[model samples]
Target: MQRPAFDPTAEEVARRVLADIRKHGDKAVQKYTKEFNGINLPPAKFAVPREERLAASASMDLLFKRTASEIFARVVRFGKASMRKDWSMATPKGGVLGEKFTPLARVGAYIPGGAAPLASTALMSVALAKIAGVPEIVACTPCDKKGQVNPYLLHALEVAGATEVYRIGGIQAIGAMAYGTAHIGKVQKIVGPGGPYVTAAKKLVYGDVDLDMVAGPSEIAVLADETAVPAHIAADLISQLEHGTGHEKALFVTPYMSLANKVLAEMERQIASLSRCESITKAAASGALFVVTDNLDTGMEVINRFAPEHFEIMTKEPRRWLQKVKNAGAVFVGAWTPESAGDFVAGPSHVLPTGGTAAFFSGLTVDSFRKRSSVIAFTRADLIETLPLIEEMGRVEGLDGHARAARIRFENPS
Candidate 1:
C-alpha cells in the first residue's frame, strides 16, 4: 500500500472555506454545494416544511422506530446523569466559592445527509441536549433529490426531542442557526460533523455561536503483535474505510512483516466481496500501511504519536499492553472488542476527533452538553479575614476601586 507522511494541507483548506462562508453567505454556500454535491438549492430551497417533518414520524419502519427510541433512552440516561447543577460551598471565614452548571438554552445540530442517513447522529445530539435540559434543539440536514428529509433521520430527531427540523444543508443552514433569520431561529451553539462547507460555516460563525471541535478525517490505528490474528486486523481496517472519503486510516505496526502481509492479504480478500469494494479497496490501498518496528514498545510509541480516533490493541495479554496506551479517542482492547462495536452499540460516543486531534479533543460525551459558572459568596467574617490581603493585592495592582470595594465590605457588613 502507498502512504505518505502526515499532511497539514487539509487544515489550510478548512480555513479557506471558512473565509468564503463569511464573505458571501448562502450564495457562496449554494455554489459550493452545486460544485461538490451536485445539488442546486435555490434561495429558500433548504427549509424543510414542518408538516413533512411531523409526517415523517409515522412513515418509518416499526423496528427502526423502536431502535431509535432505545438509542434516545440510552443517550438520555447517560446525559442526565452528567447534567450540570449549581452548587456553593461555605468556608470557615464565611466565604463561599463554588460552581454552577447550565445547559445552553438552544443548540443547532447538523446531520450529514449527502451519502448516508446519519439517524444515529440525530438521536445522539438531540437526545443528549434534551437530557441536559436545553430549551430548544434544532436539527438540520440536506434533502434528497425528491426534496424529502430522510425518514429515519427525521424519526430519530423526533424521538430525541428536537424542537424543529430544518431541511437545509451547507453554509446556509449554519448561517441561519448562527444569525437568526426569518425562517430559522438562532441557537446558542452549533454542533455535529458535516462536509467541508458546513464545517467552514461553523468556523465562520464561531464567535456568534459556540461550536464543537473542528473535525478532521477519521482514523484508526491497530497495535497488533505476532499473536494477533491477521483476519481480525484486516476486517477492522475495512470497517474504518467504509466511513467514506478521507475518513479512514489503518496502521499495522509490528515486528513481523509476515504477519503484516497476512493481514494485507486478508484485507484484499475481504474487499473483493464487499458491496462498497471500490471505496474500501482504494482506501485500504492508499490509507492502510504496515510499519516494521523494532519491538512492541516502538509500535506503541508510533501509535501514541498518531493518537488515532480508534485504537485496537491485539496482543497476548492485551490488558497488560493496554496500560501503555496513553492517547486515542477510544481504546478497544483485545480481539473480541472490535472497533465497529464502539461506533454503534457500545454505549460510548462514535463522534471522535481524528487526524491526530484526539491528543487534545475527546469523543462526544455528556460533558459536551453542559456549561459551568463560578459561584461566590462572602459573609462579614469572611470579608474581614481576607480584607487586608485583598486590599494589598488590589493596591499593588493599582486597582484602587477593588481595594475600596473590599474595604467597604469590611466597613459596612450586610
Candidate 2:
C-alpha cells in the first residue's frame, strides 16, 4: 500500500509558532497556548506546581504506582548497561588518544498528552537521562481543558526524576525548551516523541538545541507465518493504531494467505471491543496494509523497504530471520515477545525513528543524553614525528600559517 502524503501546512504552522516563541518568549508561548490549546495560562502558571505533583503521587493507585516503579527500574537497568564509558589508548610515540563521554547538564523531555497522557513516555525519556547522570531534566506535557495534567502522568514525571514539570505542550513547549523564556530555562537537548506539530517544531529548532530524533507517528510491521497466532497478530496491529493518532501505520506481511485472512478477520472481531475503535477504524482506512508474498524472502524484501519503527517476527525460527533484518528501530522475536513488551518494559526507549527513517536514524538510547569528545595528548617527540605529514597537508591546502605554527614549535624547542 502507498504511504500517506506529507502535509505542508503543518510545517508552515510550526514554523510560524516557533518563530513567534523565539522572539517573544513567554508571551508568545502563552498566546499560542490560548490559541491552540484553548487555555489561558500566564507565564507563572506554565510550570506545574510542586504541590500538584505531590498530590498526584499521593492519589495514584497502589498497583499502578508499583507498576510504574517496576518499569522505571527495568528501564534504568537497561540504560546503565547501554551507557558508553570513557576509554583511552596509548599511542606508539607516548601520546594518548581517547574519547570522554559526558552527560548533557540539562535536557527537556516532551511527554505526549493530547489524545492520551503517555505516562510511560515520562519514564522512558526521563529515566534514561537520569541514568546518564544528567543534572536537570525538565518535562512538558499538555493539560486537559480543565488546565490539569493527568495525575498518573505527573506522578510518572516525578518518579522518573524530572527536575521541573511544565503544563505546556506542542510547538510552544518545543520552542520554550529550545529558547529559554523568563519562566523556563533553555535546555541543552530535547528528547521524547510527539505528533506532527511537535515533530515539525523539533526540525525547525534542530540547530538551536540537540534533538533525540524526528519521531513522528508510531508504526509497526509484523512478519508472520503459519506458526503465528492470528489473534495476537490482529491485536498487535490494532495496538499500534490505538495510539490515538490516525497517522499510525500497521503493516502485515505473510507468506501464508490463509493466515493473513485469519488475521484480518481477527482484527475485525477484536477492534469492535476497543474503546478507541473510532481511532482504529480511521487509521485502518488510511495506514493499514496487508501483503501476501509467494515466500518468506519476498516478505523480507517488503519489510526492508518499509523499515518500520517496530518489527515483529512471529515465525518458527524468529532468530534466523532476525539476522537478515538490516533496518528497524526495534525487533521483537518470537510470539512471546510482543511489541507491547518493548513499548513498556523491554528496557529500550520507545522513542524510535518513524516515517520510514529507521533505515538511517536510530532509536533513543542512553548515549542520546550524553556527548562524546575525542581527547588527544601529544608529546614533543610525537609532534615531531607527525610534523612532516601535517606540514605537507597544510601547505597543500594553502594554509601556510598551519605549517609555520608546527615548524616554529620544533625550531624553537621551547
Candidate 3:
C-alpha cells in the first residue's frame, strides 16, 4: 500500500549487495565499491594508511587547527557532561542494584562522500564515539576517482580518534562493517548518516549490528510569525537544499501569507548566486513546502506533523514556544541561531533522523556508542523475599525451570 514502507528500489539493491557481502565478503564489497564510486581498489589497499592520516593532519593550517580545536572542545565537553556513570542504589534487602555503562568494543561510522565530503560529520559522529571510550572506532568514506579522500575529512577522522579507516561507501561499507570481511573486521555497531541507498542498507542490517537511527538526506523546517525576517527564513530553507541529494527537504510554516510570499521571493533572489544552485534549485522546487497557517499555533502543528530533522522557531519569544514541539531531531531557537552552527560547531551531534522519522527516532549522542547493563546483587534476604514472586510469575508464564533454579538455590543452601 505504501510501497513497502521504504524505497523499493533502494531496498532491492541493498538486499542483493548485502547478501553478496554476507556470502562473498571482500569480493562483493570491492565489486560494489567499483560500481558505485567508480574506483577499483584491491583489498590490500582498502585501508587508509597511518602515514596518510598523519600527512592529512600535518597539512592543515594553524587556523584550521585552532577552529577544529575549539569545536572539538565543545563536542567533548557536552559528551562528558551527558555521559552516564556507573551508579547503584541499596535495595530494601541490602542488595546492590545499578546500571553500568560499557562502551562498545568496536563501532563503524559511515561518512558521506558522494555529494560533498562531510568533514563536519566526522566530528559529529566519530568524536562522540571517542568520548564514549570506544576502543576501536572504524570509519568508512568513499574515495574519489583518484582513490583519495578529502584531506579535511581524513584529518577530521583522525582528530576524532578513528582507529581504522576504509575507503568505501554506500551499501558496501555498511555490509563490510556489519558483516566481517578479510579487509575489515565486523563492528558491533554502525553509526552516522548517508543517502537513500545507505539509509535503506542500514535498516536492512539492523540485527547484525546496532544502529543510531534512520539518518538520511538533510531536512529543515521553520515556524515563523509576523516578527520573523523573510531573508533569514529563506536562507535557512535553502541551506538544507544545497546538501546535493535530491531527497533534501525544507519547510516554512507561518501564519502570514505576506511573509510566505516575501520568503519565496527572497529564495528566488538568493539561490542564483550559490555555488550549488543548479542542484539546490531542482531540489528546492520539488521538496520545499511553504504553508500559511491560520495562526502561530496552527503553524507549529504543521511543522510538527512534518517531523523535520532541524526545526527552527523564529517567532517572537521562541523559547516560550519550544515546549509545543512534539517531533524534531534538533531545534534552533531565535534568529541568531542558524542550522549551520549546529552542523559545525554545536556541542550536539548533527547526525539526526530525517524523512519524518523524528516522530519516532532521536539524533545521535555520546551514549549511542555505548551499552548500558543493569546490575543486580541479591543478598540471601533479597533472594528469599523475591523468590515467591519469581516462582509465581514463572509458573504463570509456563516456565517452571526458572522457578526451580531459584528454589533449588535455596533448597541446597549448603
Candidate maximizing TM-score: 2
- Give candidate 2 regions above 4 Å deviation: 1-6
lDDT of 2: 0.91
Off by over 4 Å in 3: 1-5, 412-414
| TM-score of each candidate structure, all chains considered together | 0.88, 0.97, 0.97
For all predictions, the C-alpha RMSD in Å is 3.3, 1.4, 1.8
Write candidate 3's Cα lDDT for 295-396 as tens digits: 888888887888899999998899988999999999999999999899999789999998888989999999999899999999989999999999999989
Native-to-model Cα distance after best TM-score fit, residue 195 in candidate 1, in Å:
3.5
Give me candidate 2's TM-score against the actual structure. Answer: 0.97
lDDT-superior candidate, 1 or 2 = 2
Residue 272 lDDT in model 2? 92
Score candidate 1 by lDDT. 0.76
lDDT of 1 by residue, 47-142 (tens): 666677778888887888788777777777766676656777888886789997788888998887876788878876677777777888899888
Cα error, residue 375 of model 1, in Å, equals 0.7
lDDT of 3 at 172: 97
Better of 1 and 3 by lDDT: 3
